[model samples]
Target: MQDEGISRARFLAAGLAGAAGALLPAGSAAAKERWGLSYRGVCYEVTDGETAETGWNATRMRTDIRAIKDRLHADSVSVFGDGAGRLKATATEAAERGLHVWLQPRLADRPPHEILDHLAETGRHAERLRRQGARVHLSVGCEFVLFVPGIVPGADAVERIRNLMSGNYDPQQMMRRLTAFIAQAAKVGRSVFHGPLTYGAAEGDEVDWRLFDLVSVNYYSYFQDPARHVRELRKYQRRHKPVVVSEFGSCTYKGAPQKGGMGWDVVDYDKPKPEIKGHLVRSERTQAAYLTGLLDVFEAMGLYAAMTYNFVTPDAPHRRDPRYDLDMAGYSIVKTIWGTENDPTSHWHWQPKEAFHALARHYARPHRRLDPA
Candidate 1:
């Protein structure tokens, strides 16, 4: 029975693709490019103290935002936060510089009513921004797949899957909530978009294609090789959805040992104490290679938009905390606090690694095509 169901779903997807392809012209100009960078909007998780605080000083944060606007020639900026004031301020700043703003508030753990209340508040704020002649985009949550277990535990997996397929609670409920939210916001005159937690090109069971205008996918290359990564994105395009590489960056430092406690070194207490050096410096060339190759794939696939992982970090010193520190070891686009004077080739610095220059030039003059021959 499960095999038959799987085969039916594949047939439906293929039929949908054929119908849509027949309706559209071949190689029509792809969707407009809307590219930007992702980072802590207002809050940064401090490594030394293990506390979340505003990541950048007002002046530096504004400057950093402007730098991204200038460098990427982005059509818009996206920030993650739930506060109306913060979203309004970000929208104003980006609008002043002729950029749109997308907000992805954290709503995964909240109760359904609370989530609705938050979305109502966001809709109100987005409407206000629209009144002020600013473009604002709102997303319900980020990576809701990670929340499925919370909503539907392991014990209820079969029951939950049945309910989801029967249009009882999962996607059907999500669509109803989103439709109500969108209708209310539309009354106040605001345009909206949805950014779901997408893994590769495979749209999860929870995504209702009709709920969103633009399909947003976040890609992180922690476990997959480059070829597999590109193949995943190609599958996503086959669905006839305009795609966005919402988050992408590679870690070069693979937890090795270093001679001196220099640069951004954090001791992982949980690991075996055999001097685990980070992959930061060791991964610069690999990181650059990945970016170059990924960009080529994205362009060839005619992806709508792509945003790199981050822009800047807070002034806090790198310490024992794993999340930011582990990422700092190799994931940064600019060196800022993570790079050492000794390691001029560090992936974190302003000096463009091969990947940095490759992208900068690609975005600057995208008309030139590189022949595989």
Candidate 2:
């Protein structure tokens, strides 16, 4: 009886192996697609009031956009604003220049249905651009999970906070809202994208993988180490979906040894004193190294698309606002190395540092293909 059982097990194992061989497709379908860098784009956040003041001064923003475009040959731009009219005008201008646009409409605290309506209105504007042959991408929301204490300050603060911190938002509810918006946008024949804050791996909870054409993450080097950043990207790639570094930047002002300031203090509204540290000035170099390293890894992994944190300087004044003060003052390659500022004669005008040239060189022309594997 034992000898008969052993022979039967051997026969079953052989048959299973033969079945698997027959099921395997030729060369695993050849991947069907290859991932490559999307043209580097800038993330421009124009607040509601500022757009009103600036009106249609395309030259105001366009000059900076063109400058970066000339430097990097970028054909894409991402702009987010609260005003529907302003967003439309900006998208039109960008499209006319043959630049792809990603429009992020600001919606917070509105009921899901209301948010869906706003997206429909915005999608209609984007569809106009698409009809004219512009590559317009719409992100449902920007960092929707991050609950500003005051914006939604109420009895539900604790729950909202927990939901954000612990990734506790109901995935099904979030997915339903996003899918509704996506369905509305699809009616206008426009493509939609989602941008999530990439603080940790779980930050992507709000996105429904099947709903969008691409998955995007806004990651800044402020909180996590470079290795962790790459690891997170690898995990996303394993899902066979492309990833975008929607935002990336580091603080230039070296703060007190232990309390690293986030370049800006949201609560105090004051810039922290610049504690000169060895690492502060070299941040651009660090940024360049990290960026290049990620690009190398991404290319090798066959990943798609990456966009740096920003191109132009912020409108905030220096020495007063801690967050933008140090960063707008310190980490910038153009500000630190070039000795140029938005105002050349002002004290804010500091020379550019080595990191500026490092970026200029790296992005001046495409480097060798990245192959981490």
Candidate 3:
């Protein structure tokens, strides 16, 4: 889901840290507390009303959450989407499996300049999850500069973002309005949800850090110099609250890193309906390499957490036909194959990609701070 970042005082108050030698590959001494994966279940907002044959089966959600913990070795999972039922199922499953959950309520398609209602709903969800004995952080929203209606000029989120990035709008004026909205939302969030709250902002978007508890940024900036990512993250680090790299991952295609956050949008995905037709070639190695580089940078920088763009994309599944392999444009670490029922080796209608293993290795390292018992 397009939710914001994460920060929790209780997580810090506990003096938590990854186990000794678990911070990073040998030679890195930084203590990172959260290593998370963005697990996107089937949500109507993401599918755009394509739920007839696509959705996350609750029966398999628990198993998937377990795999995210055992296979990915991640301590946290950010459950994205707007479906309250799905979010509860995902978060409850993740919590049962001992994974901290950052529940992000997506507000896509909703009018911008008006998020108080969304915030209220999120607060209710967060409160319910916390009362159920789950460690939860509510991400109010994400990248409003582009997704919100009034913030940018366009019919939809895609059109709005494209217009804003086209360099025609007055950025200073837009930022002022965006920050004002966020501040108001934060006030509303504080009323209902008595826990960590944050907003996910895209890189280059100006956010008033003083308004939120955590300095979160949806940084898909691998296209630029690695130093640039560090510089941007450091600006958040100066805020004293946890700095979360809320979203970052590459599509399963060559040169996807060059597109960064827009990897999914770079390819035209509408003509064939559910099936995407594009010129980009799939390359699991490229996806793995891009993710590994970001993991290294995040570990070395000693940030609070870095959640990979996503763990699964049920709507964008793999297909035998090259033309139907729309998953190449997706950020899921695993490619879901719809008709894998006959394959005993298939893990719940999905196949893990190379990036999955690479991330597993990176997260498998021994760290006392992140996994403190």
Best by lDDT: 3
Backbone atom clashes (below 3 Å) for every candidate: 10, 15, 17
Q: Runs in model 1 with CA error above 4 Å?
A: 1-57, 131-136, 147-149, 152-206, 221-230, 252-281, 315-330, 336-358, 366-373
Candidate 1 to truth, TM: 0.58
TM-score of each: 0.58, 0.62, 0.79
Q: What CA root-mean-square deviation does each model show from the true structure?
A: 11.8, 12.9, 8.2
1-373 per-residue lDDT for model 3 (tens digits): 0000111111221222332123234443233344332321111122222454455567667767878899888877887776666766677777788777776767666765445676577678778878888777777877777656677677777788777778767777787878877777777777878777888888777777777776778877753344445555666666667667888788887777777877887444555444545566788878877777666556555666778878887767777666667688889898878755322232437778998888888777755343211
Q: What is the lDDT of candidate 1?
A: 0.44
Ranking of all predicted structures according to TM-score, beginning with the best and ending with the worst? 3, 2, 1
Query: For candidate 2, lDDT tens digit of each residue in 261-325?
Result: 23433223332533322333323444444444444434333444565544444333243333334
Q: Which ten residues in a row have the lowest lDDT in candidate 3?
A: 1-10
So what's the TM-score on candidate 3? Answer: 0.79
